[model samples]
Target: MDTLFDLDEAPATDPFDPSVSRPYDLLRHDDGADYAATVTGGGSAVVCGDAERVLAAMPAGCVRAVVTSPPYWGHRDYADPAQIGHEETVFDYIERLADLFEGVRRVLADDGSLWLNIGDSYTSGGRRTRMADRNNAARTIDFRPDTPEGMKPKDLIGVPWMLAFALRERGWYLRTEVVWNKPNGQPESVRDRPTRSHEYLFLLTKSEKYFYDVDAITGPNGRRNRSIWDINTVPLAESHDAAFPPELVYTCLSHSSERGDLVLDPFLGSGTTAMVAGSMARRFFGIELNPEYVSIITRRLAGRAAA
Candidate 1:
């Protein structure tokens, strides 16, 4: 099988530059600065910061797989006024996300795979958001929607398709789109259309061929049982604005990566990736711009160590 590990082409770009500042690298082992403590056994590290900057710190072909969910366009506040996704036009969000993926492709092991989870956006107040116009928003939102429903973008479905197309344009292989069925998802009592429960998880490979160890990250019950996995209904110890379940992370990791491979989350909200990585014996590196979140994740990881 053709693998992502084989890179005979000349380097297209140089990420190492003195001008670019290296993001914070808090290396944590099972027995060190609880905050800097790395996960025991062989796993991956979750580095924190802009994906580009974080990728710069890592050696090329160091990561076996990347499983992450970046901030959706106009979805939530990243607490950074200048960040790309927050408060930006959909077009800008897609472009910026694509830029990050470009960097991800660079550092990713030739045989590595990227599992990205992203959802669409809808404009409030009944407006139709066009995919083409949304693209321009990232550039500039000068054009206004036609009707009130059109004024704001809603039911943002094709954004991922646009992203896939963009990545394909850059030579990244477009793989299958896996649906994350939220069996117990919060109900939405909408007057029109069905409630949105599931989201799309795009499994994109760096090259046409990549490494995938399906059995490594299998759950306690294993993959033979069923495709639908249960969502953790337990309340978090602390309040995290946006957090995904460890089960989801675990499933992705177990299937896509192996022991000792690096796992990165550029948008490390509340450090779920770090926590799961530690438990599963995988190294983790997470980046959060907000100092408060950084502290929350640090304390959470520390608490895990104490437990």
Candidate 2:
């Protein structure tokens, strides 16, 4: 079996380097050579390219579980056209995600599972509010996408369910939604409702029965099967904006996969999934479109190996 793990071929791009000229510039292989070599290297293989294209190279049924938080709908743009979630409308966004996951479903084992962590966005006057562009590394107004039905100003678009139902319609068995309650939620200025403190993590399986180890993630007392999860949101100094805690990944991997099982993260932001997968003795294949983030993943893996 061919693997894609060529760390030495990576360009070692620095995120903080202001002298770097141009966008999507990676210090690694630009002709997709390292990406082709990704399957060869053992441990975590991080590919910096379009997720849809990268996932196509993966062998079917090679992944045990697919876990990663994709880009939020119109929240922030990573300055990449190939990146999802920056669509012109909420409907378009969900459709694009569902289409991307078609490859994901194909690569997933028959007994595999997919855990998706998606965030919500509010509509201002039947449209998504503008936020940071991330190209200049500053907060600014972004392009406004078309509004979806039943959304008013200051109303949450329910992006999670939109995506969930969309995926379910595409032949994926819609499973339970795990509420990720943040203990230290950011303060909000809304006076009509309570502060937002949670996001949804959907657990979907391709088949009726999958490789779920119920006893793996048991608490001290016994098996805790509650749906509401109290996991904190993680902040990173690297290029990633929305990163979940490693404990969250640990819980998902513990319940869905075993040691040495292959895991796939289609939206590898800071490479947290690969990092935690390495610590837990699981193989990880990560896909990220941003080159800077690919560099961050490379730097992070090196640090972990040294320690």
Local distance difference test scores for all models: 0.59, 0.74
In TM-score terms, candidate 1 sits at 0.72
lDDT by residue (123-241, candidate 2, tens digit) is: 75643445443343332436666556766666778999999999999989987999988886665655799878899999998998898888775555995657888766666778676
Over all chains combined, what TM-score does candidate 2 have?
0.83
Off by over 4 Å in 2: 1-41, 126-141
Q: How would you encode candidate 1's per-residue C-alpha lDDT over 108-168 as one tens digit per residue?
A: 7888888787876555433323233231222222222232222443444466777878878
